[model samples]
Target chain A: MSEVTAPMAGKVIDVKVNVGDTVSEDDELIILEAMKMEMPLVAPTSGTVKEIKCKKGDSVGADDVLVVIE
Target chain B: MLDMVMTTGVVHLTVGNLIMWLIAFFFIYLAITKNYEPLLLVPIGFGILIVNLPLTYLMQEGEGLLWKFYHYGLEWEVIPPLIFLGLGALTDFGPMIANPKTLILGAGAQFGVYVAFFGALILGFKIPEACSIGIIGGADGPTTIFTTVHLAPHLLGATAVAAYSYMSLVPIIQPPIMRLLTTEKERKIKMRQLRPVSKKEKILFPLVTVMVICLIVPASAPLMAMFMLGNLFKECGVVKRLSDAASNELMNIVTILLGISVGATMSAEHFLKPEVILVFIMGLIAFAFSTAAGILLAKFMNLFFKEKINPLIGSAGVSAVPMAARVSQVVGSKADPKNYLLMHAMGPNVAGVIGTVVAAGVFIALAG
Candidate 1:
């Protein structure tokens, strides 16, 4: 399994994928709200989602695991 | 005696007062009907009406509340920098970092400022007055106010009005020049997608910018410092309250005071001058020249760049913020709707704001 970490400190506004969902590289995985703007965190590599570690309204810090894909 | 006291207003009326009243009404009409920057024009329109009323003491020397506000807010050079703080909170610099080279387009837009500077000088305005007039090209209202307050406070009203007026008309003034400068193929050129900016980079941007700019042109510190501070508040995420306050409440209050004070300065004696007309003319020229300059520079850069940039985005360097950037998108859409230039255009659009402030700082160092 590969980890997708939170890139910034923000509240996760949405989780676009569920466990076991297949994703392509650069596909938007979640929306993070910071600096009064919404930023979408995309997948770094193509993989099938093995676990969802973050959910909507979860406060996250940089490098915190958000999703695990395999 | 009672009738005479009541009739004093009629007795004091003059043609100048009537003309000013008509002008005030025109401003109000534009604000309400056309929505031409109503946040500024509405307050300015009402203030002009209030100040122009015959025999009113609202603009009286050292006694009028409006006069006091002008003295404290503008003359003291407080409002503009404070307004910058709010602007910082609203602005996002991600596009700029993602496309660092677009900063040159921002620098290119300042060509209009110098063009107007020399034009004003040739037309017989003193150096200080010329500097104030030239900044209208920057197309940022608060920067215009800050420069005018420092360099030529007397020209403040005309310059401020002209700046905001032209800014609202960016959709009109920019398109023709944009069309004139580039071919349809160049306009339709699609730029590569920008890489996403990292969060640590966003937080560090303000701190590093302040250090570099303040050290180079200390005159720009008050405005630049407050602007960067506001950005820090937003990026740090620890000071959400400060950022929220700066963007909403503080911005609203300062804008009200700034608009009214600016309008109050438009007394017939102060505003109805040959030079004021020249200032307005120079302002239009500044904007046109700036647009042309940005487009030309982009064309010139294409000679070297491997990946061609859509030249339409270059005109957004005039710093009208999202409006100038939007014009690029609209113009590009006419050529090819598939091209998405708004995000790309924003790189230069936001950079233009920084470029204008820096240009204003240079003038302050040399002239102020």
Candidate 2:
């Protein structure tokens, strides 16, 4: 399993995938808003989504695991 | 006695005072109606109005509020460095670190500083005066004020106003030069996405930059050191309150005092001179040359690189913060609406700030 992390501390404004969904590398997984900029978090590898650890409106810290891919 | 009392204030007014009133009104108009740097021009405009009034003693040698502000805040070299602290706190070094090559573009833009320096000398300005005037090309007002106060205090009024005026006019002054220097294809070139800069790198950049710059040019340590400290405050994550104060409360108070003090220096006898006119003219040339030099250097660099950089970003090398960079984006979008050049342009834009400081350091070291 590969865990995708938040690059910075921010509020997750969107979640674009669900568990059991197939995803491609670099696909947008979440939209994080921080420092007045909207940053799209992307998948690090192509895999099936095994878990979603963050949700819309969740405040996340830098390096916090947001998704699990297998 | 009754007649004299009625006309006392009225009798003190002169043609020069009236003319200065008009100029001050024009600045206020620009600030209120045209929305040009109101944060600066408004206070400065009001200060000009107060000082131009005859016999008020509002700007008297040692007694007036405005004079005190000027002497304590600017002449003593306190406010400009504080302003840099705020600027550093607000600045993000991510883009510059992501693409370090833009530092060269920033250096290339300093071509304007030398152009204006030589131009001022040929026009009969003394060396120190010319040095202050040339820095108007850098398009960074705090640095301009800092340099002028140290080197040529008398020209402070004209140089500060000229630096800021040209800075606000970046959208107007830079586009023509950018267009004149580059081809359509060059303007349309799309740069690759910048890689993300790690947080560790961001934390180290200010410390390493301060050490390197101070070692190379000790004259810049005061300004650069404060700037780096502010950035460190912001990046450290533990000093959120200090960073907030630097960017907000402290910045606001210093800006108000600095603006009014800069305006107070523009007494009629001091401001209405042939040299002042020459300074304004030199300021225009400085902006033009800075923009052209950045674009030319980018074009020159393209000869060596496999992937071409959109040369419009070069015009952003003048250090007017996001304004010059925004102008680059607007012009690039005109050429190709799909182009997203803002982030790419920011690399050079921020670098221009450091470049201007280094250039000022060189001037102080060599000339002062």
Candidate 3:
């Protein structure tokens, strides 16, 4: 499993994928908010969402884990 | 007879050139006293004064090194792109990635380029020159300089002054246009927070942006390549020191030299023509149109969503960076102090930079 990390410093605006949901490469995993813009965290490869790391409204730092993609 | 050789051909400065000196002084005063964009204006102002001193050896072959810098650097298009590299180091794509929708706002703002292009055309300016002059509306300094140096070399002085002047006056020029276009209720519309991007995404962003831009606008490769190189140095996280130097020291040095070099282009022989007045007028028109296009795009975006977005942020699509973003905040605050749109404005503001670059590519393809 590979960990999907926050790309930048921002608040979590939304979680698009849920744990156990199968996803394809480049599918958005969660929404990270920064600079008043929404950044989507996407899957690295086709995989199932194994674990959700952060909740909505949580402030995530650069490189902070958002989800585990397996 | 020996002294006559030295006295002869001591060229007298003309009234037109003297008038150029006065205008240059105005910018110098604005930069020093009013604290206008001193970084660019002060040196540029001085350059104008020094270069215009009739028969002065400042920019001439035997005058001084200033002319060499202008000829070898600006004329050759070496300096402006390097300046862009510094700007790229300073820019944070976070705002853009957070709200990729703002990319459209950036694109929308560039409608002014075409609008101004035709405006210049209607004013009896030819296509290539008009296209170069029209680009000043994009409000991107490097792009303006780049286009002028290539498409309309003679118009460089007027176009650069207009671009930087309007950029400094952004606080003044934009508010009235923004206010007249939107109702108070529309100004208060607040947007929701942007989503988070992944670390891998940040790492890949500069690379991807470069690839996309290069494939789409190969003419802008030099600009895009240098810009992305700086961004990569910044986002890579492993090169903080290099990023710091590039963003600060390197940029500062280049700006000083480039400002003076740009100012040197304002020789009266070229700048005092009747066409210069028209170029100045067209620059303002371009700026206004870009801002209007942003507001209109915001209204368009509002149609799709129930939660209204602040249309004022749309004007930040003019690519002046934090200045445009600050204009958004100022306008938002006057409506309601709690309505801080600075961050929200940044998304499109950054995108505006990209938008301007893309617009430059279009001109380079069509005009270059």
DockQ of each: 0.05, 0.06, 0.02
What would the per-residue lDDT of candidate 1 be over residues B1-368, giving only the tens digit for each residue? 98887767877776777877888899999999999999999889888878877778887779989989998998888999999999898888888888888999998998999999999999999998999999999898999999999999999989999999999999999999999999988988988867878889999999999999889988889889999999989888999999999999999999999999989888777788888999999999998999999999999999999988899999999998888988987798677644557778888998898889998999999999
Candidate number with greatest lDDT: 2
lDDT of prediction 1: 0.88
Evaluate residue B177 in candidate 3 and report its C-alpha lDDT on the 0 to 100 scale: 95
Model 1 lDDT at residue B334 = 77
| Model 2 misplaced stretches (Cα beyond 4 Å) | A1-70, B2-7
Cα RMSD (Å) per model? 6.3, 5.8, 10.7
What DockQ does predicted model 2 obtain?
0.06
Cα error of candidate 3 at position B188, Å: 0.8
TM-score of each: 0.84, 0.85, 0.82
The order by descending DockQ is: 2, 1, 3
Residue-level lDDT for A7 in candidate 3: 48
- For model 2, name the residue pairs that clash: none
